[model samples]
Each structure stands twice: as structure tokens, then as C-alpha cells.
Target: MRSDYLGFSCLLSAVILQATAVLAADDDVLKRGAYLMNGPVACGNCHTPVGPNGPDLSKELAGGTPFDFPEFMAFSANITPDPETGIGSWSDDQIARAIREGIRPDGTVIGPPMPIEFYRHLSDDDLKAIVAYLRHLAVVKNEVPRSTFNIPLPPNYGPPIVSQGSPSPDDKIAYGGYLVAISHCLECHTPRGSDGHLDMKRAGAGGNSFPGPWGVSVSRNITPDLEDGIGSWSDDEIKAAITTGVRKDGTHLMPPMAFGYYANITGGDLDAIVAYLRTLPPQKTTN
Candidate 1:
């Protein structure tokens, strides 16, 4: 009887240790998710509704911002976990699928401006972390209107992803490219073809125009062209443009750039981004 009791105590202790480790891992995941979402990922830049003062934090991620384009009028969806109108009922898999694959549980394709093309490159681990962070958010009961697209959405973003992984941070250029992909930097900066699809050959040349309360803001050329791009700008200048929305000439950049969210990005990540930007082939803007 004494020996059996001792063994039971030992087993219980081991189980407790295992559980503690699992909890620690969970904490790390949540921290990473918070950093990405509030920082460079900046999902709220579009999803969160803006009032006179700016984004209303009380309704954070409740959604309702309208993206009125010539092709479609879309309202960002309430990503809060409210059961009645938000994503409260979505399973972990469902949320991941919606983000990375652009397909909802009901088999509907999410339309553009959502940037599913870039999100498809997100790693499995990061996707899991994002979903976990979302699941824990305070539920906000807000219903957003569906988007109407004059142009047809593709049958799917692409073949379903079986598995995905991110490049190691040690490889600065590769990892930076990965970061750029998930950030969808080129989605707005790159010029679109006559068909409205991005012209990959001229990626980062810029020329896209965005109109908002701030008036029309054109995405500048981000390529290495000294005459038309940031090739001559120092690394710090590039970083400033990203974090503070200030150009090399000291003029403040306009809205829809999400400089507020980018200001939170770590210095190391900023270095990676600048390094990657330096590698782009010299290309003049179409404009």
C-alpha cells in the first residue's frame, strides 16, 4: 500500500509539470499573436470602425468600415466572438480556413481588399496563434453587411494548403520576404493590370491611388530605382516612412498606410524589411 501511494504521488507530480509547460506554451502563443495583430499585421486598420477621433477602441475589431470601390462595396466583418453576429461560433479550423484560404465555413469566397493572397503564406503555427488570440477576445455583438463584387471571385484562392512553414529569422532576406508577403505590402503598392489583377512583373513599382477623407493618396514606388524609388534613401529613412508615415523630404504620408500600427514593430523586424526592400530591382513607377 505504501509503495502504491508513492507511485501515484510521483505520477501526479509529473502530470502537473506537463500541464504547467502546456500553459506556458499557450502564453507565448498569445503574446506573439497580440504583437502581430496589433503591430505589423494591423488587422484593425481596416476592421475597426473609425469615428471623429479615430478608431473606436471600445468596439475594437467589431468591424463596419466600408471599402467603397468601383468594383464592390464591402463592409469589414465583425471578427469579435459574439455568438449572435460575430465569429463566436466558428471553430479554430474554420477561422484558420477563412483567413488563409479566404473561404468561410459555408463555402463562400471572401472578396478582395481582404488580401487573402498574401495571408495564404502564413505559417501553420502563426495561424494557430492568431486563431487562439481571436478566440479569447471579448465578444462584441455587431453585424456587418455583406460585400457585393461586380467582378467574380475565383473558385478558390488556390489549392488548399496541406502544411506551411515560415523561413527562419536567421535568414534575414528570406524571412523579410515572408514578412512582406504576410503584410501584403505590394498589394496596394503594386500597379494593377487592365483586368484589375496585380502585375507581378512590375511589383513594387507603385501607382495605385486610394481616396478617403484624407483625399487621394498614391502608393509611391518602393523599388530600387534611384530616380523614382527609395534607392537613395538611407535605411533609417525607409524605416521612418514605414513607422511614422514621413517621407525622406519630411512630408507626412497620408492615411490607409497604417503607420500607427507599424510604429509598434520591433527594430529587428524593421531592419529585415529595409534589407528586403533594398534588394528589389530598379523600376520606375508607371505614373
Candidate 2:
């Protein structure tokens, strides 16, 4: 009788330990997801609605924001865990597909401003982490308007949904390239056509114009063109520009650059970004 009681107690302890370990792992993943979304990824900049000052902290990721472009109006979607409007009902695979393939659960393509092309390069672990973080958001009940495009979307518009492995953290250039993609650098820097679509042929040339209270600010050419881009700027100059909002010439950058948020990026990540920028081919911007 004594032996049986001891055996039962041991089994119970083992089971509790297993459950506790699982919970710990989940917590770790959630923390990582939050860091990625709020830090380098900066998903809230677009998805969250802003007030007269800045992002309404109360509504966080509830998503009633409108991105007005020359061609059409794209409204950001509410990504909270609300079942009726948010992604609460979406399965993990469904969310992964939308992020990686730009395809919705119903087989329809998610239109521009979503930057699915860059997100497609997310590693499996990072994708899972993002989903985990999103799932844990406070279930805000906000319904966003659907996006409408004036021009016909090109056939096979987004990248192919292939399972490409992400670059290791040690590979500075490759990892930086991945970070740039997910951050949607080209979406802001690359010039858009009259129809408001990115001109891929002129990528990195940087003629895109963004109008704000500060004034009409244009993205600078980030390519390796000595006369037109950052080829002449040292790596330190580039890092300072990104993190401090001060350019090599001592001019301060305006809104939409998100330098304040980027200031939180680690030194290794900044180095990686500089390393990646050095590899871009020279492309002179007409602007």
C-alpha cells in the first residue's frame, strides 16, 4: 500500500511539471512575438488607428485606419481576436497563408498596403510567433472597411508562396535583407506609378513622395549610386539617419520615417541593415 501511494505521487508530480513546462514555453513565444511586432516589424504603424497626436494606445491593433493613395483607398483591418470581425475564427494555417502567400482564407487575394510580398520571407518560427502574439491581443470589436482598387490587379501580383528558409542571425547581410523586406522599405522608398502601384524596375531609386504637416517629403535614393544615393555616406551615417532621424548633412527627417520606433533596434540589427544597404546596385533617382 505504501509503495502504491509513492508511485501515484511521483506520476502526479511528473504531470504537473510537464504542464508547467508547456506553459513556460508558450509564455516565451508570446514575449518573442510581441517584441517582433512592436519592435523591428513595427506592424502597429499601419494596422493601428491614429488620433490627432499619434497611435491611439487604447485601440492598439483594432485597425480603423485608412491609407489614402492616388489610385484607391485601402483600409487597414482589425486584427484583434474578436470572432465576428477580427482573426479570432482564423486557424493558424489560415493566418500563415495570408501572411506568406497574400491569400485570404476564402481564396481571395489581400490587396496592397498589406506588404505580403515582404512578409512571405518570414521564417516558420517568426510567422508562428506573430500569430501567437496576435491571438493574445485584447478582443477589440472594430469592423474595418474593405479595400477598393481602381486599377486591375496584375495577374500573379504577389510573390510565389514558396517555403524559403530565413537567413540566420549571424548572416548580417542576408538577415538585413530579410528585415528590410518585412519592414516594407521598398513600399515607401520605391517610386509609384500614376496608378499608385510600385514601379519594380526603378526599385531603390527613391522618388516616392509623402505629404504631411512637416511638408512634402520624398524618400531619398538608398541605392549604391554615389551621385544619387547613400553610396557616398558611411555605414555610421546610414545608422544615424535610421535611428536618430538626422541625416549626414545634419537635416532632420520628417514624419512617416518611424525613426523613433527604429531607435529601439539593437546594434547588431543596425549593422546588418548597413551591411545590406551596401550591396544595392546603383540606381539614380530622378527626383
Q: Which candidate is the best by TM-score?
A: 1
Tens digits of per-residue lDDT, candidate 1, 89-197, equal 8899999999999999999999978999999999999898888888888888887888899889998999999899999989999988888888889898899998889
The residue-by-residue lDDT of candidate 2 on 33-106, one tens digit each, is 88778767878887887888878878878987776776668898888889998888999889888777777788
**TM-score for every candidate vs. truth?**
0.97, 0.88
lDDT, residue 34, model 1: 86
What overall lDDT goes with each candidate model?
Answer: 0.90, 0.82
lDDT of 2: 0.82
Pairs of residues at least 3 apart in sequence or in different chains that clash in candidate 1: none
Q: How far in Å is the alpha carbon of 197 misplaced in model 1?
A: 0.5
As for model 1, its CA RMSD to the true structure in angstroms is: 1.1
